[model samples]
Target: MFTPEVPFLRSSATPIPGRYVLVFDSAEQTESTSIGLRARAEEVPQILESEGYSLTEYFPRLGIAVVSSAAEQLDEFQARCASRRMPTRVVPEMVYHALSAVPTPQPTDSFEDTDQATWGLQAVGAVNSEYTGAGIKVAVLDTGFDLAHPDFTGRTVVSKSFVEGEDAQDGHGHGTHCIGTACGPRTLADGRGYGVASGSDIYAGKVLGSDGSGSDATILAGIDWALENECQVISMSLGADVQQVHPPYVTAGRRALELGSLIIAAAGNNAQRSQGNPGFVGAPANSPYVMAVGALDNTLSIADFSARTLPGRGGQVDTSGPGVAIYSSWPGAEKYNTISGTSMATPHVAGIAALLAEATGFRARELWAELVQEAKRLELFSVDVGSGLTQAPPPAEA
Candidate 1:
């Protein structure tokens, strides 16, 4: 019931007119609220049957409800929610992008260059690892994937779309490219080898839309679905810059780790300290429980655009991976494209996580500790690369 005078995020997605989110302290409270709401449906004239607002969905597990109202009805709706002891906010639709596409690359003479087998695969030593992540379930939560991509033929892939009105198809190329790196085939039909966990089962969750963006609710829903399916590793190559970590993402990450799923996210591409302005790690990735990944170039140096961890703050970049001039799957006539950002770097860790999972039975925190311990130490500060670059486990036979 305590309404803080915090302003809506300036860059948060625009409010969908009249839509809001009501959060409760616990699932029991949410369920009780829902039941009480129904019992007093007639008394609450402002909501149930009035011109004020209407409930759309109630997710008791997450302790939230989606409601729609008119501009004039918002104040009354919030007051009523507060009176009912539920903290309410006009759900500011959060916009997330495929991190690889962030900071908007400048137009170069070779903008159309396309290649295969990114240096990231080599940088992480995935090229030499004998483990193919066989039997492990890896989830890539991003824009929907191209179901018809020839490179993924015969792979055991399960897909679901969280984007409203969109099917599980990669109209935007970001998801396809990330999936290509994390779970694509090892040897290409064209005789090129790219992906790391070529033999792992793929659970493609389309949290973003064809435009390469999605709201927080949609993303939360996707995360819930992925965890419910018990995927071992969830790769999120999408996020937005937010100094403080969002509460919902923190809760969700904790729940995921408890469920034995590791969520890895991109550190953001807003840094340009050489220009005297550097950005901090973005939310979801910034969550203490989520593993935040930064980008490195082929030479193992931090990418110019990769965000560094904020001093004594929540949004700290955890690990580094190859991100610059990276080539992976794309959509349509162009089967591949070279892109950059912490987004591209994240999947390398995800794929390697799958490999490590397959190599050992470590789950959640234990797996995370092993990954950091096995990373190659670098001369950079811990904030730039927590444990240096992630390296795959040696074959069990070794």
Candidate 2:
């Protein structure tokens, strides 16, 4: 089998229901990659080696950092890791971190999905494809959020923070952007926001804390929480460096599918284009059951930062979306902002999955198959955009 190996750091421990979080450089925020690569990722093996830890997983690309939910938790593990002197980050378990309210702007039409929006319109259609995800539960696992965003006013079902005992409201601003893309109020062009599943109830899990960083334990806990809630579809805007799955996290994803949940993860925002690297997809995003996604620009051109597959890979990216400077709701329902990343793109698929599940009345594998089979190939018509994106009517059922 493909047992991904990690250093002494435990891959995944107990399935603690919590938030899906990220641990990025607080100094490095999620912004459009107009220039250099914004969210840089790489394997953490160097750090582990320095820490005197042993690794044996088949996929070390899926490196994991040891973390504890308790205060001062994992101190020894961290110390061990610290001894390595490698740059490392820990994402708190995914959960919601509510931010102070941001004043809502009178709805604008800029964020609307246009016919020219290619992948963007398809996403709208995907959400409307089944139903508005009204009854079906959808989870957004990403960076911090803004609870005060007008789009999410009071619709957030459950907001929990696992960033080492942090609040569930968004602080990093990433969670809010992803949420807006997936299920925010339809208010973009003509008042339609970037949301795909307009009516679906969103549960914000701020796995990436205010600093946009988190540990593996936090991610596992967030997954566990989604399972406990029986979330129909989960959208993760975060990605890991390793190609293999995190020990327990991999198990958790499989378990989620077995329990009838579908996942949509980001293909990553690495500038493989500039690196002269061909095939480079992110982990967790690259996991077996995940619906890996890529990003595009306003003109429907693949985003320069979109992760690509090596030369021979048929479909490195399952689909693409309007990730370049995509505008969406921020936490605190306060204001509208622009951000980019496959992170922004993943939610678009999640919202679509929710709609598909509700409309088709299929869970997990069934829903996943439907989405994949139906995805328009991004490579099909560069003119039409990749995987042409998805368009589903509000699901027939929820």
Best by TM-score: 1
Q: Pick out the ten consecutive residues of candidate 1 with the lowest summed lDDT.
A: 1-10
**Model 1 C-alpha lDDT per residue in residues 216-333, reported as the tens digit of each score:** 7777778778877889899998877667666566656766776798989988776775576566788778887799998877667777778889865457878887777777888888
For every model shown, what is its TM-score relative to the native structure? Answer: 0.81, 0.66
Estimate every model's Cα lDDT from 0 to 1.
0.73, 0.56
* Model 1 global lDDT (CA atoms, 0 to 1): 0.73
Model number with the top lDDT? 1
Residue 267, model 1: lDDT of: 85
Query: In candidate 2, what are the lDDT values of residues 94-118, reduced to their tens digit?
Result: 3212111111122353345453333
Model 1 residue 181 lDDT score: 84
